[model samples]
Target: MTDIPPLPETLQFTADGLIPAIAQQFDTGEVLMMAWMNKNSLAETLATGRICYWSRSRRSLWRKGDTSGHIQKLIELRYDCDADSILVLVDQSGAACHEGTRSCFTRRLEIDGSISEAETAYPTKIDESARQ
Candidate 1:
């Protein structure tokens, strides 16, 4: 069996008591989504083994895949060097983006290194609608 490491002590949550959390697929190492989390949501997610996030717009705790059944199951959680962010390795089911994309990084960068944003759009034949 493997050990799931505990949340680190140095994570720097913001003034609003929130931290940036990035979810990545454990098997594919694909970035799933970026979300915020308060202490309560983080603790609850750890306790339940289900990914939870603080939705800034909704101003509430968001349990991943609660509505769409595209849940993210926690495998491990890690902190970056700055301690101001979190990386959550998860077993993702279905899609991660709210629009129903498998990953939040479906965009490609230009040869000049310009960044582009892309996400999935479910319920039809469409996969992505450009964010830029």
Candidate 2:
């Protein structure tokens, strides 16, 4: 069995003592989104079993799935081999994007490198009406 990794002893937080965390879906293994996290937010997230983020624009901590009910149930938190990045795998509920998309990765890129937003991954939600 894969044991849960312990929080690193030499974790290198930024000058502001914050780190960026990338969240992905555990089942589909698709990358979902990225967010910032401070030490306090990290601690609280593990302690409370909730995915928390450091909101740079708001300069505060926010628990995912709090506002829009798009909560990420923590499946695992992983550290890169270099210990510089964190990956969070989760069972996400509702839309993962603030734009009300199921994932932030709703755009499709052609083999020729052209890009286009296919459509909303999520069909209904608050941001939907606002977008239309």
Candidate 3:
């Protein structure tokens, strides 16, 4: 069994009372997605062992995989040196993107500032059936 670390005290939230949280795959070290978390969501994430994010558009607590089944299980949580950002290590179950991709960062930028999509999409087909 491992000891649970205390939540950092110096977290610096943005003006809207949110902190940028980055979710990364624990085993593969792949960046999953970037989301915002308010104090309530952050505390809930720690307490529940599930990743919870504050949805700016919906203005509610968006528990990952709750709707789309792309859940992110919290493995570890870390804060940046400035305490303005958070890193969430997680065991991702399904595609982390709404576009049915493994990662939300599938787009790439070239030196000339051109964008390109990844050749291979993970989990194969894009599932848009979850959308209403």
Candidate 4:
């Protein structure tokens, strides 16, 4: 694997020292989730080749899928033109959402100012055999 480039010094972080990061499926182009990251978490993700995010509510570093076994392997890291946001291309092992779905973006905003849950073609369902 190629080494990740060093974090640019020109990155513009928020006043709270955080930046928004969006995770996308590397091959399929599915948007998984968006999270916050700080300098430390960003560095950790690069070094480990796994996605790491900052938990604002918990006030700590959150390694993706640490407890759920839904790890996100980093394929590439990118930054937007604004330098204030990041996009993480990853190979997701399982459900990226804590809700046990492949992605967190299941809700869609309709043009009529209504919100709807997108239909799931292959919803993640618990396999009873796996518990055996």
Candidate 5:
């Protein structure tokens, strides 16, 4: 079994004790979404090998698939040189967005300033049980 590392004490957080974490597809490099992580949430994710984030609005830890069922299985975890941000490489199952989209970045902003859908952008149907 791979050894799970502890949360780094040198990691940086915002004044509110939150760090930005970007989730991406491990093999495809497709960015799924960005979320905030507190120390507790980060620790839990490291321990469980499942993605977890701090829900600022809910004031609680948000496990990626607990509600949506579009789980993000951790493949690798990385931190920027600054140690202020995180990049979570994952094998995402089903739609990663709560809106049932494959990625939260499905919309593209054109050079002309008009918003356009990405070439392969289509939302997968989420299970009814997954809806809030």
Candidate 6:
């Protein structure tokens, strides 16, 4: 196994000390979701091998799938060259979006200025408990 690199101190968080994190399916290359992460959440994810993010609404660390059972297991973590954004390759279980969709990007904007639903490989697995 290759040694994982430590989180670089050069990461550029926003004024609120948060960085945008994009989660993608490691094998399929499907983008699952995008969320925010503070330093603490990022550290926890790296240490635990599970996906975690900073919840702006809750003002705390949000562990993905903790309530919904749609956990994202970390396969790999990467930062952009600018060190302002993050990419997390993961093994996702169930839905990755709060709406119980496989991905948050289930819609597309047409060239003619209309919106359409994009085709998803998997059906949505709605979890009612996730809403709470």
User: Each prediction's Cα lDDT score?
Assistant: 0.82, 0.79, 0.86, 0.88, 0.86, 0.89
What is the alpha-carbon lDDT of model 5 when measured against the actual structure?
A: 0.86
Model 5 residue 56 distance off true place after TM-score fit, in angstroms: 0.8
Q: What TM-score goes with each of the models? A: 0.77, 0.78, 0.83, 0.83, 0.84, 0.85
Q: What CA root-mean-square deviation does each model show from the true structure? A: 7.8, 9.3, 9.5, 9.8, 9.8, 9.6
Please report how far candidate 4 places residue 30 from its true position, in Å: 0.6
**Which residue ranges in model 3 land beyond 4 Å of their true spot?**
1-7, 119-132
- Best-fitting candidate, scored by TM-score: 6
> lDDT per residue, candidate 6, 10-85, as tens digits?
9999999999999999999898899999988898898889998999999999999999999999999999999999
Model 3 scores a TM of 0.83
With a 3 Å backbone cut-off (N, CA, C), the pairs that clash in candidate 6 are none
Q: Show where candidate 5 strays beyond 4 Å.
A: 1-5, 119-132
Better of 1 and 2 by TM-score: 2
State candidate 4's TM-score.
0.83
Candidate rank order under TM-score? 6, 5, 4, 3, 2, 1
- Residue-wise lDDT of candidate 4 within 1-132, one digit each (tens)? 235447899889999999999999998888889999999899989988989999999999999989999999999999999999999999999888888888888987665889878643233465888568
Model 5, span 10-79: residue lDDT tens: 8999999999999999988888899999988888788888988999999998999998788998889999
Q: Write the per-residue lDDT of candidate 3 for residues 83-104, one digit (tens) a residue.
A: 9999999999988898898889
Give the distance in Å from residue 92's predicted Cα in candidate 2 to where it truly belongs. Answer: 0.3
For residues 1-132, write the lDDT of model 1, one tens digit per residue: 123446677889899999999998887777878999988788888888999898899999899888999999999988899999999999999988876678776776654799666553212243355423
Winning model by lDDT: 6
Worst 10 residues of 2 by lDDT: 120-129
Worst 10 residues of 6 by lDDT: 118-127
